[model samples]
Target: MNGILSMPGRSAESLVDVPHTLEPPARSTLPPSAQRSLKALRLSAGFWFLIALVGQWLFAWYIAMVYARPVLSGTPEAINNTAKITGYIVGDGLGNSLLISHVLAGGLISMLGLLQLWPWLRRRVPGLHRWNGRLFLALGMLGALSGLYLTWIRGSRLSDLGAIGISINGILILIAAVLAWVHARNRNLGQHRQWAIRAFLLVNGVWMFRLGLTAWLLLNQGPNGNTAKLDGPFDLAWSVGCYLVPIALAELYFRAESSRSPTRQWLSAGALGASSLLMALGVFGAWLMLWRPHL
Candidate 1:
């Protein structure tokens, strides 16, 4: 990043793209099967994002309905009915404020962050994309900061390890957000896009957590290695896995997209396809068990 920021003249004209940039394909040495696998990988990635967007929008709606609705209705105490922790505490003005900002901003960013990735939107309405990107980054940072404060300072987490998981997520969010902005400022669109995707994943960590939990419960027909207090083994592991899994998958997509290896492409394609299937099931479980009940 210093190399990028410290480039001699640092002008757009003088800047060079990073190796990972999704440049147009050179004439392919790839066989037809590899080409087909690459195509499948792209499609599967797109499908995964599409499913994620649907789930996220539903989650945003859930946040508004469950959290924001009460505040707007002058019954902020109603939040405690559905919220696990950090709900309206009558005397804790700062804590309540942070809770509102964290959840509301979370909803906004969930909807906005992914839009920045739309190629047609970026190409056709660059101005909107830029402005939306700025707002998305701002809200994402706010959400991360507020969430960390709530988790650690306010003691909103269910378990110590869970708090650590969320804390790690917050740090990743900050790093990714900063890098995304810096790369954009440097006119390095490839790196910017990569970092932005990471920021998106990190910001959506809570959503992923809920999805994973619901999926697990549905699969097991009940909790396994779990507890009511969220101190169970599965809960502790998921604290990190929620964000890590998505980002790791994204990295695999990046590697597969860039590589000419048929084997890598096929492997990535299969992995992405399986992940999409799991995510789809998770989304269903989340909507059925977590979100829809409240709505």
Candidate 2:
């Protein structure tokens, strides 16, 4: 009764103004592995995007001039230039059409893929995200299919192992795309994100090829300095390593994030840091020795 009548001397306003006990909001926490993974990703995302931008533009520029000028103005350098294309340019008919479609769409696809991973854009402009996602998926499938055809049916300059490696990459891209779509359909955004990243890396595997080749050349002292041509030891190594290695490391990161092992966290952090530095070097090598001269 005394407790019930405690406000008897107080005005209604004073009673209502009394502070009430409420538990503070729970503090969000991430495991150490996850924290390191996120930090590494954040630190590298911008640099990765810059490298990707260079890659897309370089591809687009080389394709347009090499293919278009030859057809439009009868330029023979087109042949010489396109001979440098990793998969080798398909001169005419269906192959050319597919390759051209990929060339024209590749940059847009990459840009949209990057944008789709943006949380703010996804929340603020969901329609744009959905449309871009569809376009990215469509272009990615077409590009990978054409690449597979070129590598297998049209004859690649690499060894049989390299061709097989490329085919495996193509298959992986298809699998990643399908998994991403399924996850999106099931409303599992987290799984969708993982699969989408896998697909993005697969789609950009050519960047690694370009970067690796340039790094090889630079290390060996430029074009004639290196005995490795289209099918060298380094090329052979990177053919499978480019896609597979990245995927493996990504999976390792996800495992660490889930398990939250401190040892794994340190290992992942060290690996990611070193890899990012190497990637920057790759970009620089590719730019200085390979694409820059052409531009």
Candidate 3:
């Protein structure tokens, strides 16, 4: 597989791992205007990752304090009172185990994934990156499976539409996970990294859903198009958009980075910057309103 997929003369890792590498074109070949556009796009992407890293770490911390702590302290039932989702069952040991595993695995994955994408880590600590990437793919598959079981077999969703949305997200996660592994096994690191990114976004659909929902609620001064069942128009759209929008933005970033056209690069940078700003707003709202109160 490696021989078939890898380039004959290329032994170095993919450029995807080292976006800020002092490569030849970046240092000398590209025109000043194109270089500037590339730099802006890189900056915007860095800003987005910075925001995501902080927000997701905070969320992981929140999960640790609110969800994992209680389970560890031998009072798992307490989670029922604290969790925003229907996370605990009073008597069902199997269900409770799955719930705890899903939540904790999610928190760990969110924390670990940011490190996997760090340019310094991948460039300098290649072994750690490879090991961590393996662990991430495994956990991602497990998380997706557990989530699907909870939403469908366990009937944890608020509405049938919401369940359908969750199912789609789970399926995407599985597909991304498989493709990422295949690419990695084939030594196609560039495609592997892209699929890994898609997997990360899909795996965090629930997290993004919370952030997007809180942002919308704050912007509207209330849950204007929301209901107790979460089957409203905005909720339905948001369930899909939470993951899709970020993936679309990532695709734009990839295209812009590869394109020599300064206009396309600048436009992609603008789109990414705008989306990052909105994500920042969402993170802020989620931190203040949802996660903070629980913590």
Candidate 3 lDDT over residue span 181-283, tens digit each: 9988998777887888899899888899988998899889998889878889899988899899989988887777877888988998899888878889899
Q: What is the lDDT of residue 21 in candidate 2?
A: 21
lDDT winner, 2 or 3: 3
Number of colliding residue pairs in each model: 0, 0, 0
Assess candidate 2 and give its lDDT. 0.61
Write model 2 residue lDDT over 1-295, tens digit each, in one string: 1221243563221211101122111124665555555444434443444445555555556555555456557543354564544432446466665555655556556445666555545666789877888788778888788777766666543557556767777788888988988988888776887787789778778767777667666666766322344555666678888887777766665554444455664575566556656666677787676666664
Error of 1 at 111 (Å): 1.6
Which stretches in model 1 have alpha-carbon errors above 4 Å? 1-20, 24-30
Clashing pairs in 1: none
lDDT of 1 by residue, 172-235 (tens): 9999999999999999988998898889889889889888888888889999988887778998
Tell me the TM-score of each prediction against the true structure. Answer: 0.90, 0.73, 0.91
Off by over 4 Å in 3: 1-27
How high is the CA lDDT of each candidate model? 0.81, 0.61, 0.81
Model 2: clashing residue pairs? none
Q: Candidate 2: minimum summed lDDT over ten consecutive residues — where?
A: 15-24
